[model samples]
Target chain A: MTVSPTRIPEATVARLPVYLRALNSLLDSDVRSCSSEELATAAGVNSAKLRKDLSHLGSYGTRGVGYDVEYLRYQISREIGLTQDWPVVIVGIGNLGHALANYSGFSSRGFRTVALLDADDSRTGELVAGLKIRSFDELTAIVHEHGVAIGVIATPAAAAQAVADQMVSAGIRSILNFAPMVLSVPDGVDVRMVDLSSELQILAYHEQRKSTLQPDDGVVA
Target chain B: MTVSPTRIPEATVARLPVYLRALNSLLDSDVRSCSSEELATAAGVNSAKLRKDLSHLGSYGTRGVGYDVEYLRYQISREIGLTQDWPVVIVGIGNLGHALANYSGFSSRGFRTVALLDADDSRTGELVAGLKIRSFDELTAIVHEHGVAIGVIATPAAAAQAVADQMVSAGIRSILNFAPMVLSVPDGVDVRMVDLSSELQILAYHEQRKSTLQPDDGVVA
Candidate 1:
């Protein structure tokens, strides 16, 4: 379904890769097809919401047979632009950056870390995940050479904004930020912040509620 | 105003931490008070949505007076149960786990990593972020001693499920998963998966749209 990407809601777009992951897992287990309920369960969402999200891509499973796992996976992947390789530039070769560079999941899902850039001159020539750490000054050249549109910032909070500004200047429009602080990018530049602490805080909130409910049982703090 | 923990919607609960962070930033800047618009902008959310989310906690800012930065920060923190320290245990001490253990955000937000566990005996006793790496076998004792309800799993995909299962047996009810795989947790257990690849894929989807809109340029690959 050659659907225009703009038509899909932002929330639905965020869930597309999740559904794609679920489909891949099903395929890995030799499952060629799955009902909405099964797919939803695997994706950790409800069937109704899953069906609604899939509908955004103009994909509606057959009534009795459910969704074709391979077909749906292809559609979602195509929608998410995973059909083509995306060259990526990652800034900040710190611990978090090192972890992201070594993460195998990126390459498995069409994202190729073309270069790792750091301001620390001493770490510039270091090899990470088979890519040599380069100076941040080479960002523009790398972006142009690879026609890269995606940038990942795994830098410290203090340097996040400068890194983002540099990325925008280099013509990169989409960013995945691991820094704790918020980044202000120019219009048309998309920034997604993955706060590691924020995720734990959310879980802590729920855990606190559990303790609140069982106040008498101090054993579970 | 006092509110039931269950009354806040999951979406609002998830956003509470963002509001807390924005308020903390405001406090850091010496800002005593802020209008809903200011807070919302700092949090990267619409004012109306921000107001609505805060209303769930029974907090309605004064008309024209706005919200007290410190007061609202405390309110949001209390709502998210960040008022008290949360003992947390992180399993798997690989690259990603090491990064997570070294992250300062968790401690700043009331989460204290009391223990770091790894299955590899060779890694035991190694110091990471000032905490000594311990064996996974010590999970039960650590959970009991620290009253730890929140667990972090940074193990590889293959070992994530096993780590999660062990966490559940050790009385952990909340999990922040960094593994690129789905986990099967029983009811009452909450698992939040932070898939780094999925975040990039979401950005790639938007980046692809930007390119599609100007196919003639062909400059953005």
Candidate 2:
């Protein structure tokens, strides 16, 4: 079944992968089918929200028997476009880039790190995750050779915008940026940033609230 | 002035950091004051939402003159508890852990990585980002000595739960998980997960939609 992008909300689209992961775990554990509540708990979401999200993809579970684990997995995977492999390139082989290159979850979810490119001449020819690091100048050539449409920027904040400019010029349509900086890309190019510091800051805000509310109930012993 | 957590919505709390970051950038560039619209654009948010968010913190921009950049920065930093240093311990010193230790953003904010713990004996005594990787058995001692309340779990999915359990037992109330698995933490403890593959999958979903909608409008060269 083909699903149109307009039919699903962006928030629902983001949660689709979480649901897919939970479904995959169920399938791995030999679970043939699961109710909406069961799937929601597995996905770390509430049942009502899970049902509403699945309804966007036309995946309402059976009234009593619930959802077929394998069928649901395939549907979610196809919806997230994981059914086809996506050639991805990492620009900047720093510590963060090294971690991204070594991440095994990428391959399982249809992302293949076709090339690891770095601007530093010293890092060139170095091997990470069995792949040789290439020069940043080779970006265009490598993108063309591998049909890489997604580029991951793990460079420092100072170099992020420049790297993004290079990626855009090289025709990368999607970018996953790890740099803690704002990147200005062309209109058509999509950029999603994962700011480790921002995540920690948010947690600190809540943690601060918790401490203030219960000063005597200190956890730090 | 201390702002009560109950006064602000969770969504507003999440966006406060973005606003603070934008203000800091303006401060760095010597922009003393900015209208809500200008600050909103800098933060990649809309003016109405920005105004509403800041209102929760009792930070209303002066009529025409706009907000005092330094004042807003101080308010946000204080509200998010960045004024105080939070001792943090990272468990599992692998590549991702290495990236976390090397991350300069943590120290710039409120988090300080006081110790790095690993279960493997081989990784112990090794230095990462100038800090020695200590044995996992030293977790309690380090947490107590450093007054660590935040724990980062960068271990593999197989070991995330065990690491989280140890962190909880060692008095860590906040956790930033990088493992690609669901971690079951007890009540009152907050967990924020950063799944790299999940983020990529979301991007792939949008990318797939773009390609399908305009099959001949290939950006890849």
Candidate 3:
């Protein structure tokens, strides 16, 4: 009943991975507990910012006392919902998709790639990650059978919308879209897009600014 | 010479894009100006939060008059360093690479994909965006010629580091990596990665938890 201030900032939620990595490092070194200052240094963030971020997830620290490393790790993991297994489907078994299928982190954590879907007939029933690559036609059944409420679209941009529409139609409400287009999803269906090119382009804009401003930042053409 | 507050909070800086999109909608509707409340409503954010965010940039708002839509748009654009043009290179032309190649937004928004590269000789010399796809062998020459400082990697996880190492070797200091692996770059190099499946898995973790947690707030799957 006293959990009135459990509203963590979205920005803080994004930084949880950085904090987790820092905590993992501390754990590896057998450090039992850490103050915000020590954790922030390991995570490349400031102590004040680290403390403020952690404060949003309830007061985990005692006054003048550091946090219990294992306790904090477990808390953060639970906060991030990594305690339970999540059935995930990665559509489009192309090069990028293949790379994603081979990614060790997904299964190592609670996130499991239950199926790999592709539209091409040649790819169908082929082995990837020991699971047969299935056609998009099996999307609905696969998702339903696996209870996969989350889908990853690593398809070509042209195929992304159709894949998304299919995913939504198949009762999947959560999407990680890799296609570089704006997806118009219905209400309650959450779509989080990861655009490889756009991120690069934004970095390029800043890098260009950095180069132009410095004049000497570039190699002569 | 007096200028607008030059230092905006990093948190506020990220939100400017969301606000910019909101203002763009207003512009499309022929709306001239908007109060912080109006803009926040359109952007699906809180008015007080929006106001505080903009305040970090400067007093772009008139006390009672609110903010001029177009003027504020321009101001924020300038503040984000989007007023200038940036040339970018896409390394490793795969499924994700093709999407980046055709994405119209990149060129439209002060960011241009100057060239697309691949390591495979067979894939090289092929045409995608009118410009012939070139081999990675020509990387140093191209980066020099285009004054390119921003690089995007659409390669497999194995080739990503090599691509990054090549980009750095060619004098590129900023990277947008789409590969699902972590890359270690030298100092002064800015690396931003967009992992497609990771974001969805994260969402799925929350989405799964949302089903268990009644009346869930913002844990999007």
Candidate 4:
């Protein structure tokens, strides 16, 4: 059965990589198959939602036997485009950018960091994770050289939009922005933000709720 | 109007910070008021969804004036518990930890980095963003001294779970994990993960779709 990639909802698409990670962990543990309940637990989602997400990829595990771990992993990997190596360029060799450049998870999965570019001339020759920090002027050359489609922006918020504009003009369409700003990109481009402050704020919201519900717990500071 | 925080759904709770950031940007730009559509555009969400989300906080703007930027900002901030400073401890002083420690967005928004703790003895006394890196054993003292409730784990994947255990023992209840592994915490403790690689994977999924739909675009490498 063929599942159209366009038909998968955004939410389901977001969850596929998570499911793939869970499946990979299972494979590492020498597990061959697992039930929806087990896979869902590994993915930190409920079984019903997990089943629904998998169904979107035309992957319905056998009723009693559960899913074939390797097979499902391949399906999700293909669906998420992880089967092909995605050449990625990291702009801005700041602390966050340095961390991202050193992050082994990307290469361990399917992302290949082809180049690290920075606007500051002083940082141009700096080596981060074995890759020399190139000049921002070299973005177009690097993108075309590596056939890069994805760009990671770890520059400060002030520089985020400008870096994004460069990435767009260089023919990159997918962006993972770590800057604490809202990036305005064209319709065809997809920008996903991973804001540290925003995540902390969300945690604070839940933390506040816990205190409100148990006022006498005396956990408040 | 008093809105009960408990009633807001998890999905809506996650988006409140984004809305708050958008409102802050508007406020910074001297925008006095904005309709649902304008705020939604700033937040990168549709107007209906933005309206529904704001309604959960009882923030229905005037019929014509839309939302008062300052007032709605305060409401969302208070709702997300950003009204008061949250004392946070960051465990790990690696590249990612350094970036997080230097992240100005957190302090600007309401979270104060009270202490930076790491298990590496050599790292102790090193200054990051003006805060001296302390030994991991100081976790308890720092948490109690600062009345800290949120802990951030930027340690390597191998050390994440152990750090989480120490944080839990030190009475920290909320965690924002940046490690590339799954963390298992007991009930009453909240954990949110920020996976950089996973975000790229999701982008690759959509990028793959675009290529599939427009094969003649010659975007594929």
Clashes of each: 0, 0, 1, 0
Fnat of each prediction?
0.79, 0.70, 0.34, 0.89
* Winner on TM-score (1 vs 2): 1
- Chain A TM-score per model, please list them: 0.94, 0.93, 0.89, 0.94
Over 4 Å off, model 1: A1-6, A214-221, B1-5, B214-221
* Candidate 4 accuracy as TM-score: 0.95
Q: Which lDDT value does model 3 have at B221?
A: 28
Writing each residue's lDDT as its tens digit, candidate 4 over B1-221 gives 56664578888988998988899899889999999999999999999999888888888899988999999998989988998889999998899999999999989988999999989989899999999999999899999999998999999998999999999998989999999878889888899988888899989988988887776654432
Model 1: per-residue Cα lDDT over A1-221, one tens digit each: 46554578888988998999999999999999999999999999999999999988888899999999999999999999999999999999888898999999999999999999999988888998898999999999999999987999998899999999999998999999999998898877889889998898888887877777764543332
lDDT of 3 by residue, A28-140 (tens): 88999888788888776788998888877664577677888888888777877777778889998876687678766577667888999999978898988788999889999
lDDT value for candidate 3? 0.75
DockQ of 2: 0.56
Instruction: Give the poorly placed runs of model 4, Cα more than 4 Å off.
Output: A1-5, A215-221, B1-5, B215-221
Task: For model 2, give the interface RMSD.
Answer: 3.6
Candidate 4 backbone collisions, by pair: none
Rank candidates, DockQ, best first.
4, 1, 2, 3
Q: How does the DockQ of candidate 4 come out?
A: 0.65
Considering only chain B, what TM-score does candidate 2 achieve? 0.92
Query: For candidate 4, what TM-score does chain B get against the true chain B?
Result: 0.94
DockQ-wise, the better of 1 and 3 is 1
lDDT for A193 in candidate 1 is 89
